[model samples]
Target: MTVNVLVPSSLSREAEDKREATRKLGYVARAATIFRADRLIVYPDRDGETGRFDDGFVSTVLRYAATPPYLRNEAWGMRDELEYVGVLPPLRAVSQTGSESNGSGSTRQGIVTEVGPEGRVRVNCGLQHPISLNTPPSMEVAEGERVTVRISSRRPVRAKLVDGPLPGLSVERTDLSTALGREDAGVCIASSRHGAELTVGRLETLAGRVDRDGMTVAFGAPERGLPEILGIEASDVVAAYDAADVDDRVDVEPTDLGFDLWLNTVPNQGSKVVRTEEALFATLAPLSLQE
Candidate 1:
């Protein structure tokens, strides 16, 4: 099932400096990657943003964190792709691909350097040098196109082209409505302290829904929660679904941000506040347990 994690562009509002901001964003990326989230979306929160924190900087650091170290230079080679900040850390995620049965070959992403006669093409698959592989007869590849390669062995370099999308954390910048409105977005959940408490039975039901529909979990900024970010009152969000009339439900969602549910993942909290990165880990931990 597809899983999308949403964080506000003002996520680094609490950071003391760019270096600290980069480090904090590293934890966010790490949390997403660890939870196996397909997409990490940064939504607009300009009002809540700090003067020192830059949305572009946040995206740059997140993109770098998502990319594998070996492919960083190639995938983000263009100078315009990212403005160099130099302080972003290498946030490497542990692979979920454990030693399992069936011996399915490992897959690696490669960039097509050149296309030759008889469908032969040169690919740079994070190796010491580029390797030439034949494209599937049905598939027509071109130069500068990204391709997936299935590697059966590394020593002898036995590999083949696998016609599919490249695998990794994808970073994006967009608005909340646009993100939730995507066709791939199934169940949209907004996390908030004022939301409904998530219990065992509730989680199971949500997991089943996630398994069927895919999910988009949205997180708020440090000081400004989603209600504030969306220009609404906390009480309105808490009682959004409490309205008796179906027609009146529109009032609850003024921004037309279609969220299936607003959830309080951490029910009994001792602390007065939860940081954005802390909230990400806390919320995704239970969701990951779902089917």
Candidate 2:
């Protein structure tokens, strides 16, 4: 097999472009005074609330802002309290790998509660909030597949696979009825400009939201009081073979409204094209700002 390599020009251009994008993002967020150069950047929030310099806004913009499954940490999507939502007590979700949790007398095998939008399925052996999987095992459980779920307090109870026979871990089932209750991926309208999702590579790479539900984000919205305002545009992505990183160099694609971004630095681990605009923006808040 033959493999093509990245030319020096391409590599340098990508590096410089990435650097400029990140720098611009920092200036827009931290700079007390806005400048003409910023008009071209993809500011996560347009409310003109300017957050901080050494803060997370800058990182979020230049990095993962749209990626999925990660927590939203904002209040806009926090629909209700843990109790009001009628969640069963934290039941431990165990996997067939003997991965049982303690205090988890929560490990109970039960019928699926209900499956909702996307790949979400809700099982109720009487538990509150879904016991999120650190790596949600494949949702191979059939509607009637005997399964065991481990319950845990202080955290969402996880459901494990038991008595059922299946393949690998993936929630993609044409028979939507296979899994329990599930919610559609949450998206923050505020961060939509960076595209539907941003890949930060690690959990700590991005800032945590004040209220993490499932979807919806605040960006710089909390500073203003309209925590969950709507009316943002979203774009469909062409998934590229690569992803951009904090310092990745790569190519840019244009979309009808928002543009597409691609990164090649993290070779092979390459990802599909991502939807982004302006390539970068200043998310930095002034160093004096508090969290």
Candidate 3:
């Protein structure tokens, strides 16, 4: 099943400096990686953005953090947004492609260094040197494109171009409406302090649904909750959940933006405000539990 995590483009508006902003985004990336999220979407929140770090800054740092260490230099090169990237933490996420190895071989993320004749391409898969491999007849690739390579033997580097998604999380930028309307967007949930308080029974039911259909969770930036970002009053969110509780209906429309549920994942939160990165861990932990 697919798990999509969404964060506002103003995610780092509360950071004190670029270093802090980049570091904060690093933890967000770490959260997505830890949860095995298929997509890390940055939805536009232009009105909520502040300071120097805008949507572009947020997306660039997130994309850079998601890149594998072996291919980072070649893939991203240099950019001003990554000036404080060294402060970012490392995300040692495992490669999903190797789950079905079964002794056949291991899969590694590779970058296409060059395209050659006869449908061949030179790929750098973190070996001592780039290797030339014939691209599959059905597949077409270009230089600088990331691909997956299955390595059978490292001694002679016996490997072949494989059709599969790259390891780890991928970053994307889009508007909230488009994200929620995706075909794979099973259950769309908005995280907010003014929403329904999560209970044991509710979690059990939500887990079952998430396991069966998948989930797309959206989070707001610091100092700006979903109610504020979406222009919906906090009272409306509370009333919607209150109404849902009266009747056993899950199809409550708190807002016209198409979110199935507005959830207060951290009920009775001690702090006055929970950072977006912190909320990611608190929220996804329970939702990711499988039976």
Best by TM-score: 3
> What TM-score, over all chains together, does every model reach?
0.83, 0.20, 0.92
Runs with alpha carbons beyond 4 Å of true place in candidate 1: 77-103, 113-119, 136-145, 241-257
**In terms of lDDT, which candidate is stronger, 2 or 3?**
3
Report the lDDT tens digits of candidate 1 across residue range 1-291. Answer: 899999998999988766778778888998998888999999988898776776777887888777767666776776542444355555555431334211358776678888999889999887678998989977889888878888777677888898887777789999889999999987788899977777776676677667777889999998899989988888877675343122222122322346777888888998999998999999998977856
Every candidate's lDDT = 0.77, 0.27, 0.86
Candidate 2 backbone clash number: 58
lDDT of 3 by residue, 1-291 (tens): 899999999999988899999999999999998988999999999998895899999999999998878788999998999999898888876763234431357777889999999999999987889999999877899999999888888776799998877766889999998999999998788888887888887777677678878999999988889889989888888766665551344333434556778788899889998889999999999989986
Worst 10 residues of 2 by lDDT: 1-10
- Candidate 2, position 103, lDDT: 55
Instruction: After the best TM-score superposition of candidate 1, give how far the Cα of residue 228 lies from its true spot, in angstroms.
Output: 0.9
For 40-126, candidate 2 gives per-residue lDDT tens digits of: 122223333232222233334322221111122321144221112121111111221134424554344444444555554554333
**CA shift at 181, candidate 1, in angstroms?**
1.2
